[model samples]
Structure formats: C-alpha cells, structure tokens
Target chain A: MTNAAADTTPAIEAFNLTKVYGSGNTEVVAMKDVSLTVARGEVVALLGPSGAGKSTLLTAIGLINPPTAGRIVIGGQPVMEADHALVDLRAFRRQHLGFIFQKSNLIPFLSAVENVQVALEINDVLPRPARSRAMELLDYLGVADRANNLPDALSGGQQQRVAVARALANEPSLILADEPTAALDSERGRQVMELFRKVAHERGAAVMVVTHDHRSLDVFDRHFEMEDGRLKNGTERNIEQ
Target chain B: MNLATKDIRHNFGRFALTTVGIGLLLMIVMGMGGIYRGLIREATLLVEKIGADLWLVQGSTRGPFAEISRVPANLEDRARAVPGVAGARRFVSHTIQREHRGRPLRMVVQGLSWPEDRGAWIPLVAGRPLRQAHFETIADRSLGLPLGEKLKLGKDVYEVVGLTKGMVGSGGDGLCFFTVSDAVSIQFDVPGEGVRLERQARRARAEGQDIGRLQPLLLERAAGPASGIPALAPPQVSAVMVTLQPGADAAQVAATFATWPDIKVYSTQQQINLLLAGMVDKARRQLGLFRVLLIIISTIIMALIIYTLTLDKIHDIAMLKLMGARNGIIVGLILQQALLIGALGYGLAYWLGTFAFPKFPRLVVIETPDLLSLAAIVLGISVLSSLLGIWKAMSVEPNKVLS
Candidate 1:
C-alpha cells in the first residue's frame, strides 16, 4: 500500500445512505438512513444477519451500487451526493477503493499472480512493475509459491489470499470485503481475519469486513452491528455488542 | 495481460476445434469465389490465346462457342482481303464423345488452319504441334491422352503428337487441336450403312425421274459411294479468325465486314463478353448466391461462439468490473478472440486451397486481389460478430459479484 498521509480525516464517511429498489407499492428499502465512518489505519467488522443490509451498505461504499439518497466522502473528497457522482466513479474506485467478495472471484483463466497483476494493469500501471508488485503482494500474503497456478488449482485459503493480494494491488485507502473468509475453516478464517488486522495497522488502509463470525471479533479495532437496514450499535476497540 | 489469449490457452483443445470447424466453412466460401473466377478464365481462354483481332461468323449468329454459326470456309480469303487485315484463318469447333481405352471420352475438337496456322500458337507442355496434320492431334492433358498414343476416331486413327495443359472449352471439356480438313471430315463422317442408305436414296430418286433412263452412268457413279459423287460442295467452317496490322483499327475492319450480308463481325473482347453474358452468367449468379449464404452462416456461427465464450465468463467479467476494469478492457477481450478466429480460419483456408483446388474437376483460380478482399471481408465479419459478445459483457453489473 502507498504510505498513508498525515491527514486526520477518516478514510470513508457515509452520511444517511439510503438505497431503495423498485417504486411505489413495490418499493423495498435495502438500506435506510445508515451513517458510518471507517478511519485510516483501523480495521472494522460489520456483523449482521442475512437481509440486514450489510452487503447493500458495503456495495454502496464500494461505489458499485450508489445509494439512492446520501453523501459519500472518501479520502476527504466528496464522491457522491444522492446517487450523483462528484467524480468519475470508476476512476475513483480504481484509485481509492478495494473489494473482496464471498468467493475468491479470481479470473479463472488467469494464474494467481496474473490475477493480482491484472488489477494493477486496470489502473494503467506498466506490466513489469505490476508484475513485480504482484509478486511482492503474493510473497507478503504467503502464497508466492502458488503464484503461477490458476485459481482453480489453488486451495480455498490460498485463493482467498490471492484475492487479498489483488485487492491490495492498487494500494487503495479503503478495503471492503464481504464474507471473505466464510468458506474457510475456523483456524484459516481466524488467520485471514488476523491478516486483515496486520494490513490495516502496517499499511494504514481502512479495512471493513462484513461477516457473521463472532469468533474473530477480537481481531478488529472496532465493530458495527446492523439489523433491519439500520445500524443497531457501533462499538469501539474489540467490544462485544 | 491479454485475457483473450489466456482464456484460449486455458481451453486450447475446444478453441482449436472450433477454429477448424470455422476454417473448413470459410474454405468453401473461398473456393466458391475461386470457381467463379475459374469459370471466367475457362470461358475466355481460347478467345484470348487465339490472338484474333476480329471474328467473321455466319450472319446474325453468335458463333463458334456460344451458339451455332456455320460459314463457308472461303470466308477466310475474304477476311484476309480486307484492308489492314494482316492474316485470316478458318475456325471450326464441335464437341464429340468417343470411346478411348474402353472409357467414354468427351473432347472439344477445334480446327487449326493448316500451312498458315499449324497449332503453333497453342501452348505446348510436351511434344510438337501437328506436323503432318491429317491424323496428328494436339491433346490437352485433361483428356488423359499420352503422347504417341493413336486412337481410332471416325474412319481415321489420329495420333496424339502434342500435349497442352489447362486447355478447356467453355463447356468444361478438354480441347484437342486438329487440321481443318480432318476436323470437317470427322464432323461429317458417316458409317458404311449410312453412306449406302444415302446413295440408295439418291439413286431411287433419280430412277423415279425420266432422266435416269438417259443418265444411267450418272446414276451408277452416284450410287457407288459418296466420295465418288461430284455434286456436293466443301464442308463449312464455324467462323473466320482475323488478325490486323499493328496500327490497324479493329472497329473499322469489323464495320467493313458488318456491311457484308453473309457474315457477322465481332472483336475478340466482344466474343468474350458474349460467352460470359450467355454461357457463364447463370452459373456465376448461382455460385455467388451460395457464397453469400455460406458467409452469412459463418458469421452467425462466429457470433454464437463468441457469445457462448462470453456467457462462460459472465462471473469473471462481473468481477473484473468490480475490480474497476474499464469497458474497453472487457470489449477488447471478446473482440480480440473473434478477430483471432477469423484470421486463423482465413490462413487455414488459403493453405488448404493450395492443394485442394487442383484436385477439383473444374479449375479454381484464386487471384491475389481476391485473397486480399476475402481477408478484409473476414475482418469486417469478425468485428460485426463480436458486437453480440461485447453487448453481453457490458451488461454485467459489478454488483452481481457482490450478490
């Protein structure tokens, strides 16, 4: 990750984000009047049950699905106001945001290293450096030996690690992951969760992970709980909700 | 970083088989064009090689090949006497089927004006032109005749004294060159029974009249054999081939012959046009229709294949968008594969055509300009075909990955 600047502004500040689907009688609120902030150099966990808007809020902050009503500021810049983009959303996403999904979601045709290198290439980085940076990320993630293998050839833990490497390829300020370790065993899941803590502390990237695994709650710097499309509680520093 | 090549490498076997299938289809399309071109070449081959500036045929007829035209052989002398005419030769052509080595053989027998034109202008692959002329023949290789092989045709046996290659008639039969007298004789030669019947009929007519009683010797001579009969004129030729001096105007000389009541005049190019317009026109349209249909089929197959490839990568495309890949990258991935298939298929077609075309009964003449045109056409098809896949890829929402 690029060095974090000495600014005190939070990495992400989302205000009264509301995402509604359909219209009139058929309207459904996926997220309603939700406000949250994730500071740089901190790892936060979003804990909720299914249909509690955890994923909806994650996608909203990731700039993939804009909230129907709200303001989103990332890295001290106003990015979206009520679904109207303040900047080119795709460029902004490439420069400042990263996402990890429930599945590894690596391009099946690309090798582990290429999966990471492609992310850099999408940001217009040259191949040689992209490859070099991909290698460093793979080495840091402890999957360097499996870098040349296709995603199908890697194990669940190894694939998730490669996905993490890819998400970190652009050195973004905010990293959002949705159930990234849901498919792993308890030991592997905790290990992946701890790796997020290391990344947040060492690289100074604000990390937000949506998960139902309360067993790894101690690894996060803070915890936010959601129910019925609203934040039920927000706790600081490894506190149980 | 090229997603197209990476995906192909991952599924090399399936991709290769698909390419081969498309390549074979493209080969047929390319071959159709070659066959049409070959037809044009075959239609104009004799006209171009005969080096005639003008042709004098029977009045109001399209002669020699396109339609039947028979003028007196004496037209050669009249054509030669025209102002600015450098030379004139008798042209006679007719198709005949005869038995050779117990197999039915078809050939277009063309007459060469003797002494003045001894088949010297014909392109020879082996042996010499008709030296003695009466029984010597110059045969095309397509006739399967070997040099020195003598075959009995009609009342005379003609020896294959020379060999030529790629000499085909407008009807797609092999061509054979013979002396004008021999050709005319072969055309009119009758069996012994036919001659006897013809002579008997003539004698019976004479006997029915009062002149038979006073002309018994005339009846006896006429009834003996047709060769002994003195009443018949010489056989007619199909046309008169004329060449002009270097500075002579062919249109002027043709106009002069056009004024003659007994003959029609045509330039060399006009004869070629008549053959193309009459003999080869329908076949050209048929082949052109088939080519267009095959191209359309190939385009549809390519579009479906690309769309399927994109469908297989739907999840990956969504993920790529989620990772901030631009629309250009996704579009490039599909477009590149389509273009690659077209380029590879075209290359395979050209390579296959080299050996396959020669084996066909009719010639397949593939020219350089046609190849270039086909390549451009294939490129256009590739681009058009890929739009389907590109549209599908572009519609994939990044949120789909999150879901």
Candidate 2:
C-alpha cells in the first residue's frame, strides 16, 4: 500500500505549530513555534521530561488535537492549517495516520489478530482480506503464534507487538507512539523499540515515538529534544549498527 | 467479527445472567397481556359458546353474568312461540362453593336445558358431553376434578363424565355443566332443620287465623312438607337463550320480545358487551395499567444496563476513537447488544410461558397479534434504550487515552 508520492516527499512536515489551552488568566501555551520534518524510512525519538510539550506536539501532528496556529503536510498533501482542517480530520487519520499509546490500549474483547483486523475494517476493507493482512503483520512482528489469544492472555511485550501490528494495519504513512514500551522490562522494551526501527526502514514509513527511557537511544535515526513548550534541538544519528 | 458479540462472549456469564433477568421481566409483561385477554375470554365465553342469537331475561335486568336476572322457567316456551325463534333453551348460572376431597372448591354452575340442549355445543377436551339428564355433568379441567369423580350438592351426587379446557366463568372460576333441574335444586337447597322450621311457622300463622278454626284441614295442609304444597310455582331460570332461524334479523326478533312486560331482551352481542363493560371493566383497566408500568420499568432497566456496559468499555472506546474508528462503529456496539438482549429475552419469555401459564390459577391466553405487537415494542425499546449508551460513548474524548 506504499504510495509513489510518499517516496518522493517527506512523510510529515510541521511548520510553526503552536497549541494553547484555556483562555485569559487560565491560558497556558503547551507548544510554541515548533517545526520539524521526518522522511520516509526513518525512525525518530521525541525526548523530554514530564510536561515538556512532547505530547502536545505529537497530537497536533497526528491531527487528533489541532494546533492553535500551524500547517501540517503528510505525504505531500496539506491536511490541517491553524486548527482549520483542509481535509476531513477523522478520515485523514484513518487513511494515513496510526497511533500506539503507553498501555498498548488493545481492545480487551478482541483477540490479537482481531485487534489488527479491526484497524483495517474501520477503513472499510473486506473482512477476508483484512484478516489475511492482519495475519501477515502479526507474522512479521513474530507474534503470529499468539494471534488468537486475547489481550489479557498476551505478555506485555507480545501485547505491545500486537499493538504495533494494529498500528501498521492500514499501511499508514506516519506512525506515532507515546511510550509504546513503558510496561515492558528493559530487554522487551529494547526489542519493541527496535521493532519500530525495523518497521520504519522495511515499510518505508516515518515513525515517531515519545519515550522516557534513554537506554534505547541508538535505535532511532534522529532525535528531537523538547523543553519549556519548545523544540530545543533536532540531531541526526549514525546508527550503522 | 462483530464487536458486540465478541464482547458478550468475553463476558458470557454476566451477559447471560443479565439476559435471563430481562427475560423474566418480559415474561411478566407478556403475562399481564395474557391475563387481560383471559378476562375478556371468560366474560364472553358462555355468550359465544352457547351459540345464542338473542337472550330473553327478566324485566329490566342484564342477567346471568353481569346482573341478577330471574325469569319464570316457562319463558323458554314463550320465547319458542315467537315467529323468528327456531329454538329456545333455559339458561341458569350461579357460582357455588362446595367441599371436595377436603378442599373448598369454588365453581360456576351452568344449567343446560336437557333433551333440548344437552351441552352438545360445548367443546370437550377429554370426554363426552352430558349424556344423562339428572346427575351426569361436564366440568372444566381447571377444577382439578378427574373423570368419574362424584361431587355432592343439594341431596344429590353428580358424576363428572366429561372435561372441557379453558372454560371459565366471568369471575375466573371453573364452570360445571348440569341439567337445569339439578342446578335449580342446588341453588335452592335448604337444610332439613330449616325446612322443618318453615313448615312450623306456616302452621302457626294458619292456626292464628279465624279461617283455620272454620276449616281444620286447611291448617293441616299448611303444616305439610313443601312437596305437597299445591300453590307453589316451578323454579325460576336466570335467562332464556334463543336461536333464530337462518337469515333472521336478531334485532327485529329482540324488538318483538322487548314489547313484553314480563321479560327483557338483548341480542347476543349486546349481552357480550354488557358482560365486558360491567363484569370485568375495572380488572381489565388494572391489568392494562400494570402492563404499561412493567414495560416502562423494563425500558429503564435496559437503559441503565446498556449505560453501565458502555462505562465498562470507556477506555476501549477512547482507544477506538483515537484509532479513527467512526461514531457508527461505537453506536453499533451498544445498539447491537441492546437488541440482542431484547430478542433473547423475548424468546425466553415464550419458551417459559408455554408450560408456566397453563398452571396459573386464572387462564392466560397468549394470542399471535399480542406476541407480534410485543416484539415490535421490544425492538423499539432496544433502540430507544441504547441511545443513552451511545450518547455517553460519543462524548468520550480520544485524548483521554493518550493521557
């Protein structure tokens, strides 16, 4: 499902993004004049302390919470400009964006395979193909043997792997994660972070993960650090290993 | 897979138990409707089963079931003499309490005119109709009297020769078919001591008169047994059932009987209307009100259940919303569960009612139209009740999952 347009353009581009909450005396600026770009086939880490505007920036780029002032382009298409949507936000998210939360957030009632299949089904994909594609993604994540198990039955790492498979179900151009491996042990957390790297390079999709763990810094192709509602720096890494 | 069913499978125990609770409520609702239908059925049973075209009752009385009506037993003959009357039968009905097998049994005694009307019109579920005129009787099976059982009343013992199903009187009591003479004897039966006292009173009153001193034989006759009395009229009947000739206008025939000063007249439909309006009007209203209240309660319970189920899935719903799952998907989850609960409950109501209703003290008549109408109402309720859950699900903020 990779598009030719995605190959020729940056996967995500944010220009002068800002987000403010409340108004008057209660007004707080969560993110300020943040700008960044991530190319296809790249994995980037957003590093910050607690309340460092990392989530605000991610949500704005994901089109979940539109910024107070910004322009967002995904796969060479303008999606949102200063909270005014250029395209249907929900539809655009379903077709091109995917998210993974800290808790895995897999629907408890569905099996591991069904969790992935539902993501495709929401996009109106027929069930037969959706299931087949879901199975393939689970196999790629090495959790195919546990595909039929419910979320509660899976190990923390396995559950996060299933969540990753679900995020990759729509072949989205951009995948965002907020502490995707927070619940796992160090070994499992590193494995999950590495899985995002493999997914980004092999599927040619841009991946951004917000994580507090500094132990897996070498897994990313680039790093963006934030402080006091502003992007402090962006640095490229040489990760030949 | 359908998320609603999958979730139900995930929580099968709780969901099954909840469905059963709902099923019981539905059963009670259905039973309320059945009870009202039964009341209507009982009130008009004799009017329809006796196959009468017109009823000749006592003057200005509704009679037999709705009001007290006592006409001369010979009115059957008078009604037969009318031009349009093809047949007329003496009809007497009264409820009696008797002891049988050490249990106080209440039954409605219906007098069937022998020779002319031997209760051939009654539908017997077990055995033959009244074959003997004096003692053989047909009883409703609901009375718990088996075949060949003998019941005593008024110095006579009657044998139960036949059984009818669903036959009841206006008061929800089982009916027993007996000859008119037997029924009248039971109605007027007096203990031996009371009879003796009545005769002694008559003798004393006669002796007190100067005519008694002039004629001693008149005084002796006044003190004799009631059977030897020369001036007593025959027993009175509650009403006379008249059947008209083919193509006879019942209204015209009733108009002719209305002219007589000794009797009142009513067409069969009029008698039925009178029975419904007078005998069971309040009871029907009570059952109808109860049914409406039960339905409202069921709806409220369903709404609360669906709302709670949605609350339990709040986190999952937020996750779905963040995943870009549309509102339709979330709505489907709640709506489908509500409908499933309703359908399963409806099915269980019928399944349980099949055996349970027959055992009720009163008749429970479940009709097809009532079933269909209930199903429609349940469907509407399912949709309406699911709205609360849908509203809550829609208000779920996707950002909550991220936080």
Candidate 3:
C-alpha cells in the first residue's frame, strides 16, 4: 500500500517474498515466504549462519535479484511485485538506495573523494555541488583527512569509513549492507557498526545489515534471525530504550 | 576525473607498452601506403618532367616503359610538320650498365636532339648544360657523378657537364642526357674488327667473280678510295616527343598520326596511365595486400589489449554496477581508453614516418591526405575494437560483488 505522506512512509516493506534457485528434481528454495518492514530511522540486523538465506533475502530487498513471488516497497513507493519491477530499477536504485559490501571495493583508479563524488555524479548532481557534498560526507564520516588518498594507501578502517561516506553521498532513504565489516578487526568492525547506527539515527534513514559478527548486535535498534530460508518466530527484538 | 585517463595513469607502464606496440604496427601500415605512393611518383616522374603533350612510338608497342617501342628518327620532323604541333624532339632512351669508381652503375641514358631544349634536359642542380656535341653529358645527381667528371660508355669517355636532381626513369634508374647523334652512335655502332672482316669478305667475293671487263669495273668499285667503307649507318630512335600549341587539342592532333603506317600516337595522360597500370600494377597490389593484413593484425591486437584490460578489472566494473553506474558509463570508459590508445599509436606512426621514409631505398611520399585518412581509420578501428570490452563490462552483474 502507498503511504499518503512521505513523513509517515515505511523505508522498506516486503510481503511473502520467495526465491527458488532451480526447478524439478534439483529445485532449491532460498527464500520462503519471507516478510519484513522497517520504519524510517530504524537500524536492523539480519543475523544468520552460512546458507541460511540471509544474503538471498538481503539481495532480493536490495532490488538486485528479484524474488519469484513478492510485493516490495521502498521509501513509500511500491517497487516490485511477483517477479515484475514497478520502477526503473537502476534509476531508482541510484536515486534512493545505498549499498556497502564486505570489501571497501572502491574503484582503485579514483581517490577517496572522487569515489564518493562519482555516486552523486551518476545521480545527475552537478560536479561542483557533488564535490562539496562529497567533502561534507567525508568530514562527517571522520575520514576527511584521507579524502585524497587512494584506497590502497588508506588503512582498512579508513577505507571502510570512506566507503560509508560514499554510501551516504546521495543521502538515500534506505541502505543495504552485506558483511560490511567482515574484513575489519574487532575494534574497526565495532566502529563501522556504530557509524551505521549514527547514519540511521541522525539521517532518519532505514538500514539493513546482514552480518555474522554478533559482537556489534547492541548497535542495532531491532534484530531478526534467519535459518533454513525462514525467519524464526516471526519475531522482532526491539532494543530496550 | 576521467576514468580512462585515471586508469591509464594508474597503470602507466602497461599502457605505454601496449600503445608503443600498436604504434609500430600502425607505422608499418602507413609505410606500406607510402611505398605505394612512392611507386606512383617514380613511375610518372619522367613523363611529368618531359613537358610533352604527345608521344609517337612504334605502333605495335604500348609505350617506351611498358614495352620496346622504336620509331624512325625522321618521325620527329614529320611530327613537327603536323599543323597543330608546336615543336618536336627525337627522344631515345635505353638502360646501360657502366663501371664507375670500380662499381657497376645502371643508368637510363636519354638522347635529345637539341642541347638547349629545357624539356629534354633534366632540371640542372649544378654546372652547365652539354656544351660539346660528342662527349658531354648531364647526369642525374643520384648517379653520384660530379660535374666535369669523365665517365666511359661503350669505348668512349664523356665529361659530366651538368648535374640534375630527381631525374629518374620509371625503373628508378638515374637518367643521363647526351646529344642525339652521339647516343645513336653509342647505341648502334659496330666494332672496328667486325667492319674490317666485312671489307675483306667483300674483296674476296669480287676477286672470285672473273669476267674480263666486269672484273676491272668491280675491282675499281670495291678498291678505289672513293668506295672505301663509309661510317656506320645512323641509329634508329625509340620515340619522338611532341609539344602542342596552347590552343591545340592534343587528342585531335594525336588522331592525325593514327593513319601513319608504322607509328602510334599517345597523349601524355595515356602514357602515364600505361606506366602506372602496366608497369607498377603488381607492386601496387602487393602493397595493398600487405596494408590490409597489417590493418587486420592491428585490429586483433587492439581488441585483445582492451579485452584483457577489461577482464583484469572485472571486480571494479562489478562494483561500479553495484553502485548504480549505468551501462553507458561503463561502456564509455572502455571506449575512451581504446580511442586514447589509437591516438597515441597514430602520433607515433606520424613521427616515425617523418624520419624514416626519406632513408628508404625507393621514394616514399608521405602526404597529408594519407595521414588524415589513416587517422580516421585508426579511430574507426578503435571504436570497433572496444566493442568486446564494452560487452564484457556491460554483462558484469552487479550482484557479483556480493558473491
């Protein structure tokens, strides 16, 4: 359902999403009737073991791999239903979604500032303003001093911080991250987790992170667990205020 | 920042090496084209310099360069008598090998009737024209003969009276100018021993025929000083060069000579075409085939370079896709890099050609139009070559970043 006002809209909503890997005797279901909803300003952790379909659910919601049967909405607009895309997925993704992967994956040829500015540029932002906004995001992410450095020149923690700056450069309403800190040390991972929390709380954006590290669970406002292509207990644990 | 430039800077050594490799190949392609142009220049050099409007040669031959064409020396006078004919000269040409400074030199000797005829003499680079009729010659500077030097040809020594530049025959041999009478003697005079033997045989035959009254008359006719052997007969000429009045139609005047029993007429343009299409046709075709093969090899090399570069950066491309970069952006990145490489290769080719062509054994004429067309072809090839990389980049699934 479409919300009447943007202020009251949920950041993400999905109903009965299912992803099947194959057909006939080799058929394997990766997501089973999964449903989820996250309000604006919410930070949620998707916790699961290997092969538990956390990545499948995350990729489906990220508009990368559409589910075989589902109704999905993002930022108050219906985006997909039953294997059909309701919008220009690439444009919509560019304008409304941000992704952070396990590796920084910064384009090696570009500096940190350029890496961040490119995201805005692809969204039709003028170069001058895009550059300023990139600097501002970098400043906010605590890696402003490293903006001119190449990815290889920066420390692991600094690279991830620059990646966060890039993800927020467009000020997207929703952010999806897959093991964003899997390569960082415990302290760097915790720092990256806290950065995501700050992004969600301060920017009023919804964040969904699929991660195996449980040490940073306290940073999430709500938590969900997945197992064997199913969400357990249909439960959502809200951190005590 | 431009993605193509940034990537190239990041991997400067590899990009430079690849560009240089392509540059060498492009240089070869352009060199082949230059050789073809050079052949055309050499083939038509004499025809252009002769300043003649028409050529009269033996009727059965194609022209002097394409085949043996010999017309009588008197044809020049007959050609001059034609109504629209402005002037005519007896032209004789033959290639001869002579020893010069211990090395054999092949020279194309051209005979001109008048020593003052500018149309017949090579463009003088040094010294004066042929001042003496029998033993003076103007030689092309390419022959390495200095002014006032004596050169022996067929038992006679001739002084080099003048020097000329760029005077070469269709076969790329340097040209030497001599008086028509001298050239005829040099080309056709029999040895003295052969002449003496002919005289003895005639006297023996006369003595063998013994009719009482007839014997005395025959002996007197054969032995008298008045009947002594005269000089060898005058030599024949190859062709006659004809000039036309300003208002005269060369084709029309040439047509008048068609009725002549043993001679054929040709316009200057026809002779040039004969030289090119008949004399240099095979060389042109072979050069064309080599150019085509080099182009094909350059394209394959470009495609492989771009494709391999793209493959090396699959992760980067996938990351760009994941970040919502449109397929167009990715395609542009690859295409721009390819074009840059093409430009670098073209620049290197032009530089190499400028310094290298002059040193080639044959003439190599590098013209502006050839370079412009080559640049266009290189650009087109770059675009075509980048297609494989574009396809590979576009097909990179954004979801691969997750895996």
Q: Whole-model Cα lDDT per candidate?
A: 0.91, 0.90, 0.85
Report iRMS (Å) of candidate 3.
1.2
What stretches of model 2 exceed 4 Å from their correct place? A1-6, B209-214, B227-231
Provide TM-scores for the models.
Answer: 0.96, 0.96, 0.91
Per-residue lDDT of B100 in model 2: 90
Model 1: fraction of the reference interface contacts it also forms: 0.73
Go through the candidates in order and give each one's DockQ. 0.77, 0.73, 0.61
What are the root-mean-square deviations of the candidates from the true structure over C-alphas?
Answer: 1.8, 1.9, 3.8
Candidate 2's TM-score reads 0.96
Show where candidate 3 strays beyond 4 Å: A1-6, A233-241, B116-121, B181-233
Worst 10 residues of 2 chain A by lDDT: A1-10
Sorting all predicted structures by DockQ, with the top scorer first, yields 1, 2, 3
TM-score of chain B of 1: 0.96
Determine which window of 10 residues in candidate 3 chain A has minimal summed lDDT: A1-10
- lDDT by residue for model 1 over B214-295, one digit each (tens)? 8989789768866677676578899999999999987888889989999998899889989999869999999999989999
